[model samples]
Target: MNGRLIAIGDIHGCHQEFADLLQLIKLEPGDQLILLGDLVNRGPDSHRVVELARQHGAIALLGNHERRLLAARRNPDKVKVRDSEKATYSQLDDADWAYLNAMPLTHEVPELNMVFVHGGFLPDRSWREQGADIVTEVQVIDRDGRPCKRREAPEALPWADHWTGPPFVVYGHTPRDDVYKLKWSLCLDTACAMGGQLTAFILPERRLVQVKARRRYYP
Candidate 1:
């Protein structure tokens, strides 16, 4: 409570960039580092990324990437793993699997009226009742008033644009070149695995800290 409540964007296995961003932030004692999931896959070292999060005592959320991987692990015959995620799937050890299993869908800061999640939520529904299928993957809201990925509803507005909140949301998962700031939410995924910057949002001060990726790790 005394230190900053920090939420970082999707890491996507860009371990070096993640490390650099952490150094840049000068993470202090008592700071709560909430990782908005996707801590693995699509970058250089998923294992190292997980290690760093554990070392820093970060609270990791469950992103779609993590959710998919977990599903595959639970019932591989029923789920298809993406080619891009194959390396990370194989790289994760038992501890990493345990870590992923323990991740929460969201973390809340009641006093600040804030909820840190891996992805945006359905604005029209109870945020608390929504499942990972919606919260970990939604980017836009379709004309039918459903949560959808942007490509699924190209002309629709982002869920954040419609969110009216008592609980301001901070989330990741939808990668962009910059942070998407709205009155009720903030999207911090800056596409770090795709030659973009890794972003961190610090509460109380409402400051942003970023570190440019060393290079594009994925196309």
Candidate 2:
């Protein structure tokens, strides 16, 4: 297979698994690796995951988990705290928070007509405006689940299927048993931290490559 645009799913701080997957993919310096975010939290070595991605110049988006981590680090009382054997609230440093906050929520590669986001895209809105407008309007649920209105389907979100722009949106918030391709979107998150496989989709060719975790890496 020729080298192409490779987008990985939600990492959730499984540094070992993430590193193993990188080795499995045989990543070259020329290959572009797009990470779909949730890089930290719920797993071990969240700091390492961020650093590795940074060192490799990987394209990473800011997922909800990262948002929560930033929020917690900024103001711990606002969000409910959880205990885990892996890295937790007390473990993150100032640089970690800076790195998380510096990440963009969405990244668009107009040349390839591909857009990368931590979650799905809003078809009705531009990616630039997504954070300021939509994210704040929606009420955030617990870290473990999707944010939704009371009694609404978890998959249901404002403009969940609205993208009609040039670049096809590729995201990773909702994990699936397999890669999910919609009319204008693709979901690559296979929940690697939950003992599931981490997936990557090659754009245009739409080929799928995945690395399954050997065990539950997250607490």
The best candidate in terms of TM-score = 1
- Candidate 2, TM-score vs. the true structure? 0.79
What C-alpha RMSD separates each model from the true structure? 0.9, 4.7
Q: What is the lDDT of residue 19 in candidate 2?
A: 89
Candidate 1 local distance difference test against the native: 0.91
Candidate 2 lDDT by residue in tens digits, 5-75: 68898888788888888887777867778888888777677888888888788877777777776666678
Q: Write the per-residue lDDT of candidate 1 for residues 40-135, one digit (tens) a residue.
A: 998999999998999889999999989999999999999978898889988999999999999999898999999999888897778999998889
TM-score attained by model 1 = 0.97
Worst lDDT run of 10 residues, candidate 2, spans: 132-141
lDDT of 1 at 31: 94
Worst 10 residues of 1 by lDDT: 117-126
How do all models score by TM-score?
Answer: 0.97, 0.79
